[model samples]
Target: MFQRRKVIGVMGSGTQAHRERVIPLARWIAEHGYDLLTGAGNGVMRTAAEAFVAVAGRTGISIGIVPGQATARGYRPRPGYPNPAIELPVFTHLPLSGKQGQELASRNHLNVLSAQALVILPGGEGTRAEAALAARYRRPAILFGAAREFRSFPEAFERLATLEEVCDWLLGVMR
Candidate 1:
């Protein structure tokens, strides 16, 4: 749950395009008065955090549900990937790489639980899983990117490919 600011969960890939798209969206979200929620690893997550900080003038309280233990190695947001915008990062000791899909599933569940809405960018299996979970939860999941990438996912909610459309929805419809 969010405290002072409304929390919007962003699920996107670590890919380059995902980074480009999610970052601005994150800035818009912050400018419009909302907190960012993400996986907090790399690529899209880092960019979002960075953008939010840049626009907000400081890294507001954004949640990063990391997928590992609370150690130096796990806590660090990765080299050359520092997002000063990131404030609080909640680390989960569950090893997402090892066996037991239960851990990853549980973490994803927690990620969805912490947000009121979702913004999905192009990603792989993990991103898809988060999107699917958000839909099943009946939360508004906004898909942003090119039309082809949006086509790949199941169209269960409002789908907007452009930043303007996405922002309009976030301001008018989603609000």
Candidate 2:
């Protein structure tokens, strides 16, 4: 069968509140059979994966993009580098630093472009960078949670305060 599930990229902070919000959103996406793509780190990434796994009869996949994977030693493996919820992990091994290097940029670029749409959760520069890339690539992005605080979104971005609104927008638009 030649079937490609539209991937939904999730960007966000690792805060407790952020994770709390992502839980429901991730479950909805999984229940609806939409694949997911995330940075594959801890905090929000783990929360999303956990939420996806919590659902039954979920056919969607969880893909994690691990940056700075140049080599096993390129970057230290954190406790939850590849969260258990991830069914597949793309180790980019980008030459740039995993945190903030050219490699991270490459990862963010790929994450933003690969997905049909993105649901951005409030985070730091990495999350913000993903939003900027979405603008540069003209990708549809729905900003959720504290990310809405980041006013001045680019032309392609829309700020959604709730998970339901973000999910609805993604399903309605990304089909």
Q: What lDDT would each prediction earn against the true structure?
A: 0.69, 0.74
Stretches of candidate 1 off by over 4 Å are 1-4, 17-19, 56-59, 69-84, 97-105
lDDT of 1 by residue, 1-175 (tens): 8655678887777554465577778878887777788877676777887777777364346778776544765453333332455577776664352123224535676667788778888877667767767777777778877768766576796677788888877776445
Off by over 4 Å in 2: 15-17, 71-79, 95-105, 146-148, 152-156
Q: Please, what's the RMSD in Å of model 1?
A: 4.1
Per-model tally of clashing residue pairs? 0, 4
Candidate 2 per-residue lDDT over residues 57-83, each given as its tens digit: 988899988765444555544345677
